[model samples]
Target: MTEMVRDNPALARFELGDGDALAVAHYRIADGAMIFTHTEVPRRLRGRGIATRLIAGALDSARARGLRIVPLCSFVVDYLERHPEADDRAD
Candidate 1:
């Protein structure tokens, strides 16, 4: 099971750990926007919707903070493209 998404601003990433493996979506605030920089889900954790969840967490956080989003990561952009729910949240 995925734990609640937690922000580690010092590292600029939202962490989703599943005991042994971890998934993360990174972001940085710039020019009043949250720029999503990267996303990584351990190979073993692929196809489990972990990246999707991580992206959701990141985007949700951005919205909660009332920040625009500049998705620098292709994965994040693609994910948003596929999921309109998140795409609508992008800025």
Candidate 2:
């Protein structure tokens, strides 16, 4: 399992196993939308679904704040493309 924590504004951190796996998604609030700039899951952690979890958590956070999402990150864009349900909150 992976652990996600909102470390601060515009950032969320995720971890898996005994390693410090991190997914860094950049965001900015504008016009009631959470404009996601980019997201990165370390190369070593790729294909493990950590990025998905991280994006999911970020979307959940946006939903909680009544904000829409604009997935600018290629990884996030690809993720949203596959998970249509998450696009409901996208701007």
Best by lDDT: 1
TM-score of each: 0.90, 0.79
Q: List the residue pairs that clash in candidate 2.
A: none
Given candidate 2, what's the lDDT at residue 13?
A: 34
Q: Positional deviation of 10 in candidate 2, in angstroms?
A: 6.3
lDDT of each: 0.85, 0.70
lDDT of 2 by residue, 16-63 (tens): 331765557777887888887777668887887777777887788888
* Candidate maximizing TM-score: 1
lDDT of 1 by residue, 30-83 (tens): 777889888998998899888888888888888888888888899988988898
